[model samples]
Target: MARFFGWLFLIFLLGATYFWQPDFFQHSYSILKHGDIVSLAEYLRSFGAWSIVVTIILFIVMTFTIVFPFMILSGAAGIIYGLFWGVVISWTGEVIGAVVMFIFARYFFRQIIAGWITKSKYLKQVDDYSAANGFKALLIARLLPLAPSGIITAVAAISRISFKDFMLATIFGKLPPVIIKVLIGHDIVFAGENMTRLIVLVIVVIGVYVGLWWYKRHKDQNKVKY
Candidate 1:
């Protein structure tokens, strides 16, 4: 009963947004198509005291909607609020959005998913691995920025991971990328006056990816030896 209502509510919200604010969707699409960070910032600022609230809501909406990439809004936040507050605001929205999606997936779909997983030996092993290292796996996924945020949240939701582990991993893992995007966005708007800083951040991101790859290979080699 509750599950039915929950799904109904989500559908309603999506429909309402689509129908009630057609211009809002069109405008967001336009900004995304042109990659116009400056205009996005200006649009947000036009909201006056409500700008922060508006930005957060947009981030939440972005989680379910794929029309725009997440970085555009994060960058706009940086342009509007600067580094520290931009990260704080964007992170808060992202966490909230992710948690909402996770809860929905877990509550409504986990049972159906469990049956599917049990039928496949490969999937069962993957599920076991996720159950054992949910935190680490989720954290790495969040840190890498390779998968869509919605997909990661959904996969974790259906796994054996506890809510506490999910929340902690999410909070910590999301911080770095948010900070990086904010920095890159801010620097880009300034005509790359901070080119050196941007280059250093790029290198750090590459190093982290390399380290993760090496660790995965080493772990796999150990498994084969056993």
Candidate 2:
């Protein structure tokens, strides 16, 4: 069943890339050339709603294997949906993708991943922290948005973490930054005097990373010795 889903996902993703690439480019161009600032903004606003829907679908399809696919789709979503709906859709999709990937990974790759990570010194802390504060570790990882979270989801699948905790942390941790990005996308799509939005986006992403790093370090230090 897992392999079948994996293969199915793989084939469709390839087809989407090959077939949809041209249409995507065209859509981007058409949106850009809608004439005048007012018209463009209106078009983007309309598109943003639809873009959120598309992004949600794509995110569900892509899962957590690679980040690029979602990023590209999010860019499109932002271009069309603007920042508000774009980010919302993109973020929602990402959370869904993370959840799906985590569940799948737990089913398919948990044991293998657990054994592999157990052997690595650097990953030892991650393993330890994940084992001790499984949900919190996953939450921090989700919040920080470091390392493709799909990996963390995979880890959580294997760990002893409860499904409820995993889902809760994943959803909550992902909310803030995802919302920020969606809004940023909204502003970018609008394309007017919004330097503050742009600056805030960069700062927020960076700050999230820093916070995640600090959290990980703290968690590692306070880790219960096995």
Best by TM-score: 1
Question: What digit string (tens of lDDT, one per residue) describes model 1 on residues 1-226?
Answer: 8888988998998899789978876787788678888999998888899999888878877886745667788889998998899999988988998898888889999988999999999989988988889999999899975347888888899998889999999999998888887777777777558889878877877888889889989999999999
Q: List the residue pairs that clash in candidate 1.
A: none
Candidate 1: misplaced stretches above 4 Å? Answer: 145-147, 217-226
Model 1's lDDT to the true fold?
A: 0.85
Candidate 2, residues 1-226, lDDT tens digits: the string is: 7677976986797688658666654553454344233333443355554745544655665564353423445555566655566676777888888877777777677667778777888777766666678877777677653346666677688776878888888888887656664555445544477778778787877886787679878888888553
**Reference-based TM-score of each model:** 0.89, 0.61
Clashing pairs in 2: 48-81, 82-186, 83-182, 83-185, 83-186, 87-182
The positional error of residue 36 in candidate 1, measured at the CA in angstroms, is 1.7
